[model samples]
Structures are given as C-alpha cells and as structure tokens.
Target chain A: MSVLAFPPPVESEAAETLRAEVRAFLADANAARTPLERAESWNGFDREFSRALGRRGWLGMTWPKEYGGHERSAFERYVVVEETLAAGAPVAAHWIADRQSGPTLLRHGTEAQKRAILPRIAAGECVFCIGMSEPDAGSDLAATRARAERQGDGSWKVNGTKLWTTYGHEADYMILFCRTSGTPADRHEGTSQLLVDMRMTSGVTVRPIHDLMGQHHFNEVHFEDAVLPPDALLGTEGQGWAQVMGELAHERSGPERFLSSIQLLIELIGALRGSESLAAQAAVGRLFAHLVTLRRMSRGVAALLEAGDDPTTHAAIVKDLGATFEQELPDIARSLVDEEPDLRSTSDFAAVLAYTMMAAPAFSLRGGTREILRGIIARQLGLR
Target chain B: MDDVSSIIFESAQRLLSDLSERVSAGRPMADCERADGWRQIEEMGLPFALMSEAQGGLGLSDAEAFELVRICGRNVVPWPLVDTMLANRFATQGGAAPAEGPIDTLGELTAEQKERAALARAMQMAGALDVILVMTISHVQERSQFGRPLAKFQAVQHSLAVLAGEVAAGQAAAEHAVARLARGGAAATLAIGIARARIGEACSKAAAIAHQLHGAIGYAREHRLHLYTTSLWRWRDEYGTQTWWTRQVGREVLAAGPDAFWPAVTGA
Candidate 1:
C-alpha cells in the first residue's frame, strides 16, 4: 500500500497541553547537562530521571490506570517522547519497558505475569530488555537457535545464546524468543517466548559488547541450561513468531526514530545563528522539510497503534525514512559549519558534531538494517 | 483526510474517468477546449472552491479545496484548474471579483501570488508523482526480464522501494503545506517554501528512477508517461525554479534563527 493510504494525524488540544508540560519539565531537568552529554541522545541512562518521569505520570501513559498508568491518549505519550528526545534527556532506564515490554505483557502475557510486572514498569522501577537477536539470527530471526524445552514436571529448561540484547545486565526480565519443538530450519513453526527473570533464573550470563564508540549499549546473554518455573512461558506455544512481530511493530514506531538527532540540528542552528550563506539556509530548510514530513508519517503510525491496528508495515517505512534523515544529519552539519569534529572540543558544535559523526552509522544498522527494511516495504508493495 | 475532501476526490475521479475514455477515443483533451468538462467542473464551482462561503464558493480549507487540483494532476487533465482555483481565491482576497474562467499559466505574479502559486504547483506535482508510482509498480510487476518479472529481482525491488519513499515524502510535504496554506502567516510562508523545495527534489529523483525502470516506452511521446513527467518538469520551474526556492527557504530559515525554527515546524 502507498504510504499516503495512512490516516492523517490530528493531535488533540490535551496532547499539546501535555507537550508544553513536557517541554517545561525538560528545560529544568536538562539544564545542568553538558552538550556532549546531551549528545548521547536516547542511550543516556539516568535511573533518577526515569523515576522522576514516573512521578509526573509520563511512564506508561497509554495503559490501564489499574496498572499504575495515567491512561492518556497515545498522542499525549507521543508528545512527551518527542519533547524528551528533543531535549536529549537521559531516558534509557525506562525506555524499553515503557515503549514495548509493558504493552507486550498486556497483550500476550499470562494474567499473573501482567500483575507481577506491569506496575513496576509503570513506576519506572523495572527496566526491560529484548531477547530476540541471536548471534546466528540477526536479520533471519526465524533462524533463532536459542531453545527452551518443557520438563516432565511442567518446568522449563532454557539453553543457547542471545546477541545484542541492549542493557540486558541491567534489565529485570527478558521476553525471550526461542525454539521449543523444531530444528533451526523450521523458520516459524516451533518458536515460543519465555519471560526470563534475570534475578530468578539460573545460569544466565550477560557478556558486554562495546561498540566502536566504546559505549556499552549492547550485550550477549547466554542461557547455559537455565531453569525457569512453569509460569515463564509468555504467550502460547508456537506463537513466538507472531508475538515478536507485535513487539516489533511497537519497537519501530515512535518519535524517537526521527528526533534522536534534534540536538545536532539545534547546535547547527545555534552555530550558524546569523549566517546569510545560501547553502546554510537552504540546507537547514531542507532538513526541516524532511523533519516535518517524517513527523507526520510517524504520528500517523502512532494513531494506527492507538486505534489497536497492527502498524508493522507503516512503522517499517517510518523507521527506514527516519533512519535516512538521521544518518545524513552529521554530514549536513559538517557542510554548514566550519567546525572540526572533536568529542572533547570546547565548542559545543564541534563536540556534538563529533559525537554524531561517530554514532550516525548505527542509525540504519540498528533495530532492523536498511536492506531488510526495504525488503519489507517491497513485499508490502506486492513486489514479492 | 476529511469527509469533504474524500467526496470531492471521488467526484473528480468519476468525472475524469469518463472524460479520459473520450480522450482515448481520439478527442484528446489537449486538442479541443473541452468546454463540456469545463462546464461540469464550473458547476461544481471548483474555480472559486478556495473562497469563503460569502464569496459564492464552498468554504473549504486550502488542502480540502485543492483535492480537485490534485485529481486533475493525477489524470493529467488538460486544463488550468490549479491556476484558476488559486487566482480566484487570491482575487477575492485582493477585493477583485473571482475570475469567471481558467486563468493564465504565464504571467508575472505578485509576492503573495508567487508563494501561493508555488504551493499549487507542488500539490499538482505531488499527485503526478503518485500516479507515476502506480503505473511503474504495475509495469515492473508485469514486464519480464531474464524470464522473470522485473520486480522479482532484488535490484528492481530496492529501486522501486526508493521510488515509493520519494513519492510518499513528496506527497506528505505538499499535504503539510496545503493544510497550512489557508492560515497564511510566517509559518505558512516557511511551509510553502519547504514544500516547493522538497517536492522539487522528490520529483527529480522519482522521475529518474521511474523512467529508468520503464525503459524505452516511458520515454516515448505516444506513451501516457510523458503526460505526467512533462507536467512534473514544467511545474517545478514555472512558479520558481527549484534552485531559487531552495535558496529562499535557506535564507529565510536562517533569518528566523534556531530558537524560532523548531516551534515554527511544530506550530507551538
């Protein structure tokens, strides 16, 4: 389907009011942080900041109030997310739980699991990590080699490894995607999701994987014959493939996909505050054009998510388009301003540029690679 | 987007489908004045659709009123509907009576006229790009190469995906500006500038990929492809050359400065 087939987004007045509230909160919260620190973007972890957001009822903004949520519209939650991302607030501590895990539990989790985990997530006291990507199964997720089998007594034994599990060591639980009944070649037939409680489960090991920027944003978790109770199964047997898709639809659609580099754009504008160069103005204006359009598309997908429709196809398009915008940002900055990129540079422009230049490559590589995303879009277009 | 827009959209589609059949039977819309189509259109009062209700027109928002213009673009209708709608609305604003018939595509425009015309051109180009994508997707799916449909190849699939992105983004930029056009402020000015600039870029890139994929048939005058590509080429240059608007947007945005920039985008 054409992307124009998406419904036009209309934000309520209450959502805008919530936006102003978020902007005010961020101005105070982010005041003391350095530009270089702000350049850390979404991965800046501050547990206190996460808890503060919970106090403001920004966490779990769309879930049931009975689950410690405020039950606001998704647009309001969207407003809060865009503002925090624009401000470069340290939001990683509660990002995963707030964005996907709580919603996943509310969808496919056992009633007991939702009761046990949902409130703590809403309170920002719990952090969640995804356990989908294994070393052998990055893009070909169905090739997942991780296994969890039933014991005769109704317990479970988990084995194999999960790669690139972001913040796994720090997370309270992992919604693991693994094989239960079939061999590795059985792409979709035998997979199931199990909620691995890092504290409660035995034989779980998280080995850090430092990226090229020397950041510890990802890890590999190994389950060496890990033991779990009967209640660990997340959804139903043989439904992990479908359940993981639901999680990914949530994973991909959000203001974070596009607003991750607002700080870079801000600093670029600040540095060239009064320049009359045609190149600078046209370049910045072009960036704004892309931003405005991307925001509209992303908001449309948010509306789809809010209305309880599966937004996988539209979300992939947004994520791909947003990644292109983000990946191209540092080059635009370098062209407009004459600053050399340096992480320790005294100039905020230089430092932020340096940070973005290093981090920009991951924009297209993470979540899902660009090639993979385009294939999804192609299939949606009926090319497959 | 809204009910009125969809209503006009469906009406336009039906009207154009009937007229296109007549053209296919050799009464090409370009050859004759096609006064019958014009009369039907005038009955719908599309010429003054942008004017407020007091001005003897449907009081539609700029984006809503432009649905007729977009449909005209999609069908490559041989009329100056875009220019007429824009001129009529502008005439009412200037204390002149709304124009009775089609307006000139060539004439020096006032400052405000130029901005509105640029937005109108972008809207038309957006629609043309959409239809071109539909045509190209069908061609790639049906045409064979090396014993397989072209779309079955990974290379063609990736290229078409890129084309779809451009089409989607171009339409979005135009829709955003059209929604802001009726407001008519500094924000509107910036929005129009963005649409004109970005859609021009999308047009260039999208046309290239689409034409390449269609190969020889797309380049021939006999094919329906020229009907849209020619319009895309002409519209991007008519109101303001893409180069001129790109620079204007650049200078104006810098003049607005960074602090005012993001707020302008979000309209907060």
Candidate 2:
C-alpha cells in the first residue's frame, strides 16, 4: 500500500510581516461585526470589506503586479488567508475569485481574458463562481449533459443547468464546464471550460437556493442558449476535466477547509474563560491541536502547489481530515458546557453554538463530500 | 531525504531491520539489553547528529532527527533512544559534557527538551500506527467468521477507516512538530504542545481500534502486534500526557485574553 506523504513544514519569513498587516487591518474592519456575523465564517460577504482588502493589495498577493496584484510570495498569500479565516473576515465576495478562479485563469486563461478579468478580480470588483455540477451531475461531473454547439463565426451556443453554484446569483462570471465534441462514452475527453460573463450574457437566469440555515449563499443557474465568443474557452477545448482537477486541488486544501467553525471555538473559549472546567480546557486544547495539525498539512499542500506539484491525493486527505474536525467542533463545545444552544440568546456562546450546530452539517458536503473524498484517498492507498 | 539523512537513515534502517528480525524470532523487549542497541546506535553517532560541529557532532537538521525517530518507531526499537538523543542535545546546550555511552535516562528536562522529546514520541506513535494498521488490514482480509472473510463485513471496513483517520492525524501532528522544530521559531513550543496532545489522543483511538480489529490474537504475548501497541501505550504517557499538554495550552491561551484567542489558535 502506498502511504501518504506530506512535504516538510515551511515557516515563511513573510509570515510575521504579512500577519501583522492583516491583523491590523482586521482589527478595525471587524470592530463592529457581531459574533453571529463572524459565525457566518467565510460565507459572510461584505463588499466594502472585500474592496478594502483589494485596496490593500491582499486579494491576489501571489499574482503579478501588472495584473493589479501585490507580486507577493505564496507563503505571504497563505498568511493573509490563514489570518483572514481565523478572524472570520467577510471575504466571501472575493473568496472564490481569489482562491481558485484567479489562479486557474492565470494558469490557463487566454492573454486577452487575463488582461480583462484579472485586474477586476484583483480589485475585488469581479466575483466568480464554478459551473461544474449540473442537475444530473455532482461528484461524477463527467455525467454532465450540458452541451456547447459551435455556431457561425466560430462562436458557441451553450445550454445547461448548473446547481449549487455558490454566490452565482451575485457573481460577475462563471468558469463553465460543458461537453464540446464527444459522446457521454468519451467521459472526460470532450469537456471544455468556458468563461461565461454573467453581466453581459443573455438568456441566463440565476435563482437563489437558500441553505438549511436560511442563507441565500447558493444558486441554481440556467443557461438557455447562452452565446459565447471563441475566446471564452479556457485552456484548450476538451481539456476542462484535467483543468478542473487542478483547480480542485486549490479549492480543497485552503485554511478555509478547517477554519469554518473558528467563531464557535473562539466563543467557547470566551465563555469558559477563567472557569474551573478542566474538561472544557482539555477539549479546547485538543481542538486546537487538531486545527494546528490540519493547518500544517494544508500549508504543506500550499507549498506543493507553489512548487508546481500535482497534489491531488494530498489535497483530498487535507479536506477529509479538515471536514472531520470542522464537523466535530460544535459537538466538542457542547460536551464541555451545560447550556442550551440558542441563536437569539443573550449569551454569545449559546448563539454561536446554535449557529455552528446548524452549519456543521454542511462542512463535509460543501467543498467535496466526505464520501467522494474518501474514495479518492482509498484509491490513493491502492485500495481500488 | 538529504545526503546526510539518507546515508544515516539507510545504515540505521539496515541495522534496525536486523534487530527487528531477531526480535521477531521470539525475543521480547525485556530480553533485549538497552545498552546493546544503544551501543550500535551510538557507534552510528545518531544521538549526536543534532549537536554542533564544535561539540563533535554532524550538526544535522531537526528534520533528519525526526526521520531518525520515525525509523526507530517503525522498527519497534526497545531502547529509550529518543530520550537519550534529546539528553545529548540538552547536555551539550547546558555546557555539560555530552555522554559518550548510551544515556540511561535524563535527569530534569527543560521545557524545550520536554516538548522536543514529546514530538519524537509522537513520531514513534505514528510509526507504531503504520505497523498496527498494516497488520490489522491483513488480518481482517485473511481471518474468517460467519462463513466469510472478516474483510467482507461492512462494519469491519468502517472500523478500519476510522483507524486510518487516527493514523493520518497522528502523522500530520508529528510532521507539524517536526516543521516547527526545524524552524526554531517562537511558536515551536505551542506546536510541540499540540503535537503531543493530538498524537497522544490518536494513540488511544488507534490502539483500541487496532486491538479490536485484530481480535484476541493481538493481545497475545507471542503475537508481534503487541510490540507496536505496547510501545504506543508507553510513548503516549511519556514526555507529556495528553491531559498535561492540553492543560498547558489551555492556560496559556486563556491568559492571553479572548481577543487573542484567534491569533493564538493561528499562532500568528
């Protein structure tokens, strides 16, 4: 059996410098946000706060300066992400764009597309969404029946429905993956990624899909004969399957994978502050231990990505372990204290507890489900 | 993975593999003199690998030392080699003469030494976890019950999955500690605390699941599985217990105030 290997740990020289800058900015930016607002985690969207981060050049720290980025190292960008997630920064507006979309575009986008979209994304004015999962396809994305037919003048007509598109209703663009040239038997071969401009595209509809927590962060997008120019295709035609796999590596291994419940954890620590609950103290310590381990692994994956390695299996492990920790935080908090969870309670602890209990169930399902992740890991172990 | 570490690890692995074969032939840990193994390790100069050149050592990196510890764990080495390695570093740093022979046991330990040793122990636990998991997976595939191989049972597969998770967590925790020690930064102590506590916790879950998966045979004195699990039990309590490290982390964070909680968690 092949064992998993994480690259040796890395401590960047830029960690402290960038950490201080991010911390100083977060202190004032988060001054008025409530515990519940912070409880929203990265799902908390604030346009002004995102714009402010862009102004400070934190949005695309690893990209080139000519693209309106700060031209910082990946480690510096990692520091920004870790600090932002820990403080529960309202980064959802630019989160998808900055995390995976921008990176993917930089890797495979046409030069013209990069010039037009990269600067706006870096400025936090352009938000992006993934358009991979369709009504008939989720984890098994190859089952995608969405078709793009080539039209006159080398353009294309796209028709399909994408589901569970996070921030799609508010997004400015989508990296749409659809079938271009082969039958379903071709599976991964016929797929291609198209850059769909949400603002300018006609016959496209976005319907909000409120989560169980009553939050409208997800959407269902319908592309009814949406017309796109030839330059819209990312990378090459029939290479979207490979391209998306590379993008998934970025999506799966970020600090956001594990820090989704930091607000609950912070609130628990505050509630038990100076109390004589050894169990609570021990629980908090254990949670931090798991978190620290996950962060190291996540950072190791970041290093691998920065080194231009394909860490597909490594990223899967990080996400699976991260999901376990995120889903378990609320339960551990509950076992340590003896209070009823109440979202409206005067106690911030109870409110966070209530909120986290509702949100924890989605931690495993959101990025990539636990089942899909485990299958990948099992295959990596040579079990399949 | 460097030239120095690769050369040292290769030689040590060969020597340790020979020792493992001897132990596998039927000798228990109690029968093996601690000094005999220490002499071989000392001759290889592994205990002094992390000391400075002026102190007569190769002055290798912490990552090399960590790999050595993991190798020792994988072989189920009976001696307290990790403790002695740390003693050499501590003694040299304290301006005391480095011990020439196998160190019996350390006297009092500094906080840094304790944390470092705890990380080594965690790596040992990770190594033990690998052996235990491999053994159990094989056992479940071969052993049969209810007219079918044990591996055919859904419950057994799920149990094995949980054990794998614990193993993964332990390795992650130990690697994090290794990285922290290599950096030698201010956050090293906290990283060590987390490693000891998290790996210690994983050891418990791993041990139970391993024993359960192996059935009654795992507990037998004659079975090789006990060598790994028993060492895990000993290592989990040594250096620092999960409760001790946890309490230390808790007290430190709480004293920093609620506002510092996030920063403390992130080690920023």
Docking class of 1: medium
After superposition on all C-alphas, the RMSD of every candidate to the true structure, in Å, is 2.6, 3.5
DockQ of each: 0.59, 0.46
lDDT of 2 by residue, B1-268 (tens): 6786788888888887666755752465443455576677778887787677789777677787777778788886656666667788888888987787666678788777777778888887877788788888788878999998777676776566667767877888877777767557558877777888888888898889989988888878778888888888888888778788887777677666578877666662
Best by TM-score: 1
Candidate lDDT (C-alpha), each: 0.83, 0.82
TM match of model 1 to true structure: 0.94
Clashing pairs in 1: A281-B250, A282-B250
Can you write out model 1's per-residue Cα lDDT over B5-113, one digit (the tens) per residue?
7887787778765665455422465534488878887887777777788988777666666666677677776668778888787778778898766887536678788
Q: Report the CAPRI category for model 2.
A: acceptable
TM-score of each: 0.94, 0.89
Question: What C-alpha lDDT does candidate 1 achieve relative to the native structure?
Answer: 0.83
Per-residue lDDT of candidate 1, residues A1-384 (tens digit): 234466678769999888788888888988998878888888998989999999899999888887788889999988888888877899899999999889989889887898888889888889889999988899999999999889998989999999988889789899999999989888999999999899878899999999888989899999998998988999899999999988888889988888777888888888887787777877877887788888887888988988988787788878888998998999999887777899888998899998888988888877888888889889988999
